[model samples]
Target: VKEICSYMGVSSDTVYRWVETHEMPVHRMGRLFKFKISEIDAWVKAGGANRKPQKGNSQ
Candidate 1:
């Protein structure tokens, strides 16, 4: 999580919040969350990170 946060240049809180609120590319195993570098790269390229919260949707 920390690595992904640093790679994305965002805080851990933001990552966690996005996982909870947005459709970020992530997987969970038991209590742990996992991500794939390739998938993350693709997601970023697809404007996943640039997405803004929708109107009327609280973040």
Candidate 2:
């Protein structure tokens, strides 16, 4: 989470929110969240991170 936050310039909370609401591709190792740079790049290129949450949803 720390690495990704640095890479993306976003907070850990934002990453967690994206994972929950935007289907950001991530691997779960028990309680740990794992990410691949390639997958993250692809997701970003595909506009995954630019998506807004649905109406009535709160971050």
Candidate 3:
């Protein structure tokens, strides 16, 4: 998780929120979350990480 967070340059909370909202690609193994560098790279390339402003966001 830390590695993924570092690679994505985001905090763990953001990652968790993305996973919960089905916005990020990840795998679950029991209580563990798994990720592949290739898949994440592909997702980003496809604009998965291009976050749009939420409806109520102040920013």
Candidate 4:
């Protein structure tokens, strides 16, 4: 859990809140939170916000 939090750059509390608030899907294994890497990656992709163009990419 801590590792995933670090990878996502979010606190554990935030992750819990996200789960509680239905921000993302969560998997449970015998009362333990088990998040799959693929799910998280998919969630991040699905939750992507519009990005602005950078000057460097404008060329």
What is candidate 3's lDDT per residue for 1-59, written digit by digit as tens?
Answer: 88999999999998887777676889999999999999999989988888653554331
Q: Using lDDT as the measure, which candidate wins?
A: 2
Which tens-of-lDDT digit does each residue in 1-59 have in candidate 2?
Answer: 99999999999999999887746889989999999999999999998888887765544
Model 2 misplacement above 4 A: 54-59
Residue pair clashes in candidate 3: none
Return the TM-score for candidate 2, rounded to 2 decimals: 0.84
lDDT of 1 at 26: 89
TM per prediction: 0.80, 0.84, 0.80, 0.68
- Whole-model lDDT, model 3: 0.83
Report each candidate's C-alpha RMSD, comma-separated, in the order given: 2.5, 2.8, 4.9, 11.1
Better by lDDT, candidate 3 or 1: 1
RMSD of 3: 4.9
On lDDT, who's better, 1 or 4?
1
**lDDT ranking from best to worst?**
2, 1, 3, 4
Decoy 3 TM-score against native? 0.80
Task: Write down the worst ten-residue block by lDDT for model 3.
Answer: 50-59
Candidate 4 local lDDT, 1-59, one digit each (tens): 68779879889987776666555567878878888888888878976212222344321
Considering every candidate listed, which one attains the maximal TM-score? 2
Residue ranges of candidate 4 with Cα displaced over 4 Å: 48-59
Clashing pairs in 4: none
Shift in Å, residue 59, candidate 2: 15
Q: CA lDDT of each candidate?
A: 0.84, 0.88, 0.83, 0.68
Q: Count the backbone clashes (under 3 Å) in each candidate.
A: 0, 0, 0, 0
